[model samples]
Target: MPILEVTKITKQFGGLTANHNISMHVDEGSITAVIGPNGAGKTTFFNMITGVYQPTSGDIKLNGESLLKLKPDEVAKKGVSRTFQNIRLFGEMSVIENVLIGMHTHLKTNLFGIFLNLPATKKEEIEAEKEAYRLLKYFGLESLLNEKACNLSYGAQRKLEIARALATKPKLILLDEPAAGMNPKETKELTEIIKRMGEEFNVSILLIEHDMKLVMEISEHIIVLDHGEKIAEGNPKAIRTNPKVIEAYLGSAAIH
Candidate 1:
């Protein structure tokens, strides 16, 4: 069975339908790319899957269980985590601390226990720190662990955001525009990291990327969306040759 299944999912903002009866399956341990031009409802579809918005119709399932009715936190607890198109990090906090915050859902300490630094809380805190460092090291950010998040370069910041998402211990990760604002070198590095995340970490990935090079290089399967609907779904080679995809990129000089 597929790790995630989106069945006829639709979302409307007033009279504007952002997603229309979109259905797809994300396989286990694979990188699935959702590609499209701006305003193709890629982010909107991502929001629905991550529970930032509920679907107007249809169902989403993870391992055959419904996720349509779950709240965002509940969804995360069910082993789903996502990184935003825009980097969201605590700028003033140390990089390691920022990652540990992502572990809040798994932490057992309550307000009272945290205030007193109870032994149990201390132990959990230590464990969280260890896990955070491991993730940072995995992403080549171990050297920046003690530095403020804002002090890192743009590419490092992006890596930090991904590290935070991974800190949540998700089985499936949704990456929204992971290559946005990146230079060619950074984008290339990100492509490798994404592949490693699936292979080494054993997590499934669903990516929304505008960088066609990155998408084509990394994704095992590609799904193209245009104006709130799926226009193409296939392997990288097929998507590259798709006429609809060519049309979508026609006026977008940057895409070519």
Candidate 2:
């Protein structure tokens, strides 16, 4: 079953079409990837899916319900969560606090309850803190739970962003260039972590990445976009050998 579906969605900024009629689907509990060179409308596509930008045409659905009219926060509440291409963490906040913020959309306690320190509110707060700690531990950051996000190493910060996204318990999570600044060792570890995340976190994964090694090794399906249009899509082997994908994004040497 598809957890998310985008049908011929397009985005226009005046006369500029950042995304042409593009369509794709991500199966529940699978890891899929969107790949292309810079300016291929990849980020624009992500924006549309996450409700950062509304599509000029076509529909986006989650669990078969249309998300076309929803704003970013609304979409998030509907079980969609995402990480930006550039890491967007709360640098001034403690690592654990950052993860707690991601849980806000689904938090059960009302502000009034919290303000009054009701028993239910206190119970919810404790559970939220426990969940946040578990997420931090999953990323091996439990030891640094109280450290400022800005004080963490670059790779740790990347993992923290993903941990926070998982905090939402999303049905679908989109990662934009999650490996952008990682060294080989960190990327390798991330590949294994991503491979297990669907099962461990119970969420489907859709990602935009330039790392072919990571994409090929972990993605069950791949979509290639170039110049604002989809050029090819297939499983790892088919995508690796596709001429259009090779020419447009992967280059001729992609076949191995």
Candidate 3:
């Protein structure tokens, strides 16, 4: 079964309908991309999935359980985690600390146990640090584990955000515009990392990205959205030649 199933979901703000009867699914252990021009309600679609905005209509299910009425944290606990389009890292904290924070959702130590430094709590903390290190290493940020998040370069910071999200060990990870500001070299590196990410971490990936090269290279499946509606969905080969997708990005003039 697909890890995430969004069915006929719609979201509105007063008179504005940000998303209109959109439906899509992400299969387990696959890389999926959601692509569109700016203001295509891509972010709105993500918001609904992450519980930042409840849908006005329709249902969202993760592993067959409805996610309506759940908060973002609740959604995370349900095995869905995400990184933002804009980096939202704790600037002053060390890179490892930032990732450790993401593991908070599953960490079980209460304040009392932590304050006492009980054996079990200490063991859990050690395992968490090791796992965080493993994630940073995967992203090649392990050596800078003690560096402040704000001090990292833009590309590294993006990787850090993704590492943090993976710290949750979620079944699915949502990435919003992950390649937004990378140079060609950085984007290339990221493309390779993402291609291997699903299998490396044993998770499914659903991302929104404007970088067509990255999207086409890494996405096994692509969903194209235009004006908050799904216009086409297929593998890269089909989407690349899809006339409707062409019109959405270029114009009627280009298609002719």
Worst 10 residues of 3 by lDDT: 247-256
With a 3 Å backbone cut-off (N, CA, C), the pairs that clash in candidate 2 are none
The TM-score of candidate 2 is 0.97
lDDT per residue for candidate 2 within 1-256, as digits (tens), equals: 9999999999999999999999999999999999998999999999999899999999999999999879999999999999988899999999999999999888998979978999999999999999999988888899999999999999899999999999998999999999989999999988998998999999999999989999999999999999999999999999988888888854566534
User: How does model 1 fare in lDDT?
Assistant: 0.91
Candidate 3: give its CA RMSD in angstroms. Answer: 2.0
User: Clashes in model 3: which pairs?
Assistant: none
- lDDT tens per residue, model 3, 181-245: 99999999899998898999899999999888888888999999999899999998898889888
lDDT (C-alpha) at residue 85 in model 3: 89
Is 1 or 3 the stronger prediction by lDDT?
A: 3
lDDT of each: 0.91, 0.93, 0.93
Error in Å for residue 168 of model 1: 0.5
Kindly report which residue stretches of model 1 are placed more than 4 angstroms away from their true locations once superposed. 251-256
Cα lDDT for residue 147, model 2?
A: 99
